[model samples]
Structures are given as structure tokens and as C-alpha cells.
Target: MSNAPVYDIDPATFWADPYPDLARMRAQTPVCFVPQLGATLITRRDDIFVNEKNVDVFSSDQPQGLMTVLMGQNMMRKDGDDHMHERRAIFPTVSPKTVKNVWKAQFEAATARALDRLAGQDRADLVKDFAMEVSAEALKSITGLTNMDWREMDRVSQGMIDGCSNYAGDPAVTAHCDDCTASIDRHISERMGALRSDPDLSLIAVQTQAGLDEAQMRANVKLAISGGQNEPRDAIAGAAWALLTHPQWLRAARAGDISWLQVFEEYARWISPIGMSPRRIARDHDLNGIALKAEDRLFFMFGSGNRDETVFARPDIFDPSQDIAPAISFGAGPHFCAGAWASRCLIAEVALPMLFERFTDIALVGDAPFGGWAFRGPLSVPVRLR
Candidate 1:
């Protein structure tokens, strides 16, 4: 075992709010082993920013990791040329040009339709009612699984996400994840037949036309759904909660003092939707005076890094005035989120603006709750729509 300091934490407490413990870890031991997580956590901002790109030392190619085991080997679990190859294969669907020319209008229509549906309601759970609907519909267009309803898309995506993060080896979580992957496989199979006859620029269609085998196509699309559905879902709802709570900032944006893109960037920094990225220690090496062994589990704590006091002023506060260029919400490495541009377009350009425009008097109903550390977001944002 390495000589790194050991930090013990109550799993339940950490799950609810990891920032306090993460802050201590960053201040005391940047590289320490967390027994509960069964991985060495690198918690400092600069350390993760610099080391995440050092693929040779801290590698993403974890063959035995949970994501690969449950979700199959997606591009996120690969390194170097292998990762770029899969990324290029699906570029047609997620590329900035495609997102602008093709997806932008679709995202706008979806957001508008969702807003119309909620127009009659005076109160709603934004997470389930609004954010989930818009995120899933946009995702259906991107993944070419228009056959699956928005609810099923959200359900299966959450299942696979839970399965990937089931480090405790929960049998129920694993079983549900299996079912979700199976469901996704069936959807992909059904969609492939349609795409062959009438092709489109969706992830499944483009990958199939590019001659990627069935397994790769399934894995890659699953990968897209896993992050695509939840991250945007969370961000859309969470950002709304942030603005409603901080009316001053909301007023600034409404007055054109700040861009909605800035709000998204700041909120992403404050509470990262994708909080942690797990890695495997490819070879024996020392990181920040801590001895690490080959094949040992490691985690780049992006949530902690974003809140590192040395990097961002008022790191804990959700203030939009701060410079957010150092934020790694989309990650800072080879696996830097592939769907970032799409997410930005959906949430910042279409979802947030149109949402406030539709319901100008929107306000929180009671309390909006948040959970999870690995994948963090508002669990539910109860709001008064009228």
C-alpha cells in the first residue's frame, strides 16, 4: 500500500454533501486514499488540471471499471488514438456545426413544446416535469431513439448511471443497469433498421453509416444517453433554481448585463453535474509525495477542484461575477465532454432563455433538494410557474 494519508468518511453523509470533506482533503492531503470509495482521491484544482491530461500516468482505460463492466467499453473508457477514433466516428451527430445547423432548431422546438405543456400548471417539479422532458426529447433527437418516450429515456439513463456508480456492488443496482442496457440495445436494434432505409444525422445513424459494429454503436449511444440525459436535465433545473434564488443575477441577465452562457458556466462551476472522473494508475508513480501502485484505482475530483479556494474566489458561493475560465465542469483532458457544445446550446441558448421568457414570474414553491457527489444535481426543483 502507498504511504498516502487515509481519509475515512461516512458514505451517506458524503453522498449528501461531499464539499466539506472534499475541502478538508484539498487543504490537508491533495492525494489521499479514501477507504469508503476504495480509491485514491486527488482533490486539488491544479493537480487534477495538470494530471488529467497525463494519460500515461493516470489512465482512463479501465477495463475492469464499473462503466466498462456495466455499460460496455465506450470511448470514455479508452485512451489516446483509440479514444479519438470513437470520438471521430460520432462527430457528425455532436459536432458544433451539426449542433448549430441541425440540433439548435430541434432543441428550440422541444423546449417550446415543453413550455407550452407546462403553461397551464401553476406549480411543477422542474426536474421531473420540465427539465427531464426537454432533456430527454433533445436526447431522443441526438441519439436517434425517437421511438423511446422521454420518460423511458430518463429512466434507462438513470439506471445505467446508477449502475456505473454502484461501486458498492449493489445487486439491485446492477440488475436494473442490466435491464437498462438491454432496453437500450433493443432500441438501437429497432432504430438501426429505420436508419438504414432512411438515414439521418443522429448518433446511431451516423455511427452505423460509418461502419461501426453493433456493440460499439450500442456502447457509444449508451454513453451519450448516460451523460446527455442527466447532466443537462440537472443543469437546466439547477440553473433555474440558482437564478430564482439569486434574483439579482437573474435581473442582470434579464437586463443584458450578463449572458445566459455566463450563468450556465458559473452554475456548472459552483456545482459540477459530473463531479468526479475515475482513473486507473497505469504504472507505479509518486503523485504529490504519495506513492501510487500500478493498476490502483484513482479519482479526479472535479467538483472539489472547481471549489478549490486557491483557484476561484468565493468558490462555494454560486456567484456569477467570478471568473470561471478555470472551471473544469466539462473536464480538461482527452475525454473532455464530447457533448459540451450540444449541452451549452440546449441549456444556455434554448432552454434557460425560453423558459424564463415563457414563465416570467417563476419562483420556487418550497425547497429544491440536491443529492449525489459523483454525479451531482438538483433532485427536485419545486417551483411556482405562474
Candidate 2:
């Protein structure tokens, strides 16, 4: 084992604001091991972008990993052929063509319904009231869990996310995640009968038609809910907060000088919702002079990579006009987020513009403080909507 820098941090403080530590790591020891996290972090953009695709060395399959243990072995936990097979199966629901032809309208309707709910309110937390509602409603349609309440979708997603990230072995978090997975399994079972009789272009329906077993189906749905709900939810609210505070950009976007899609992309680059992805070293390897052993836990810090100084100009600032083509907010490997198109369409094409249009003037009541380095976004975007 090669000597790696032992970087110590107060987990609480790091969770609140990780950029400073990340930037420090990038400058000093980009491949240091954090004992608190029990994982080696790769902070540079180039390193992750290059190495992430090398799945032979940095594999995704980890049976003992938190996500696999807590949420079952979903495609995201698989590698190579296994991952691709699952990705292809679910592609019908999230493919760009499908998103444009089918889900976009559904997404618009969901956003509209969420906006209607906010019509009566003057002040509200966009995180819960608007963002969460819009994302959850659209997720229900996409996942074919229309029988499940929007709140229930959000609840289970959060539970699984917390459980997967529960590195401290919090039994309560693990138990909650177990409960969430159990609920998902029940929902999947309930919906399967109808889906077989009258199949549609939802994740569960498509995967079922593809002949995935019950365990796999449940895992995929749980995976979708885990990411599908929160990332877009956070992006919708986070991008709104970003553009609202940066009025010049918001005005430009509303005026059509800057595209809403551009704003979404930029905000995603700035504060990536799916921040760190955990990987297990599949074999002993040398990465940029740092020795990595087989089974050593590692994290590809997508958040830090998006803000790499060498790649992005003024990487810390959120600029819609800047070229974000290089950002790996959705990842760059075979395990890249399959719902990228759907998320973009939902947040940019539907949720953000519709919400702004519905309310004449939407302003922040106060600062909306953000939390979480792994899955980061505003805790509550308290805003006054007119």
C-alpha cells in the first residue's frame, strides 16, 4: 500500500461546505484518503473523466457497498455488460426521443398542476411546496407508480438516499431505508398486474416487458426514485434560487436572450445534485502515482470535478453563458445518469419557466441555505410568489 495523505475533517463541517476542502485537495493532494469517509477522493476533472470510463480498474459493482446493501443491486451498481443490458431495458422511458414525444407533455402537465397548487400561496418553501411536488408528480408518471402518492414518492426516495449515504452505520437510517425499499416492492407488485394487461412507456412497464425479474424490477424502480425525485427536485429549486438571485441571468433567460436550458446546465454544473459517486477498486492499480489496492473504496467527486479551475473559467461562479459541455454533473461513464434527458426537459423546459410564468414576480424571502456535499441542494428555498 502506497502512503496516502490522511486528510481529517469534521464530517458535519464538510457536509455543510465541502468546496473549500475539495479545492484544497485539488491543489495539494487530489488523491488523498479521508478516514472519515473511508474512501479515497479523486478531485480533478481530468482524472475522473478519464478514469471513470476505465471500469476494469475502477469498477461499480460492490455487493457490500451501502447502495447495494440498502437498495439492492441496481444497474448503477453493475458494470459493463450487466449495466448496459439494464440501461437498454429502461431506455424506452428516458430516451431523448421518448422524452420529447411522450414524457415532455406529461412533464408539462405535472408542472402545471404543481404551479396550480402554489397559486393560492404568497410565501412558500419551493423545495417542498413547488420543486418536490413537480419532480414527484412527474416521477410517478415515469415510474408508473401512479397509484403512489407524490408525498410517498418523495418520502421513499429520501429514505433510500439517506440510507445509502449512511456511512456512519446509523441503524435508524438503515431501518428507514429498508422500510422505503419494502414500500417500493409493494408498489411495484401492485402495479405489475395492470402494467402487464396494458403496458406503457414507464420504467417498470418497459423493464417488465424486457423480462427483468421481480428483484431487478424493484431495484431499478428504487434506483429511479432515489435519483429521479431529488436531483431534479433540487435542480428545479436550486436553479430557481440561482436565477432569482442572479436577476440579470433570469431576465435574460425570460427574455429569450439566454435559454432556460442553458440556465439548467449551468446550475447543474455549479451545484451538482449527484455529487460523489462511490467506486470500489477492482484491481490493484496506480493512478497518477497513487497506489490503489483491490477493494479500496474511492469516490469520484463530480461536484469538485465540475468546478476544476483548469477546465472551467471562474469555476466557482454560476454563469449560464459559460460553456458547460465539459461538466460531468451527469457523469461520463457507461453508468452515466440515464435520466439526463428527462431531468433537463423537466427542470428547464417545464418546471422553471412555468413556475416563473405562473407567478408574476417570485423573489426570495431570505437566503436559502444549501446542505449536503454528496447530494447537495437548497434545504428550503423560501420565496414570496405573486
Off by over 4 Å in 2: none
lDDT of 1 by residue, 200-270 (tens): 99999998898888889889999999999999999999999999999999999888899999999999999
TM-score of each model, paired residue for residue:
0.99, 0.99
Clashing residue pairs, candidate 1? none
What is the lDDT of every predicted structure here? 0.93, 0.92
State the TM-score for model 2: 0.99
Model 2 has an lDDT value of: 0.92
* lDDT over C-alpha atoms for residue 289 of model 2: 79
lDDT of 2 by residue, 75-190 (tens): 99999889999999999999999999999999898888878888888899999998998999999999999999999999999999999899999999999999999998888889
* Most accurate candidate by lDDT: 1
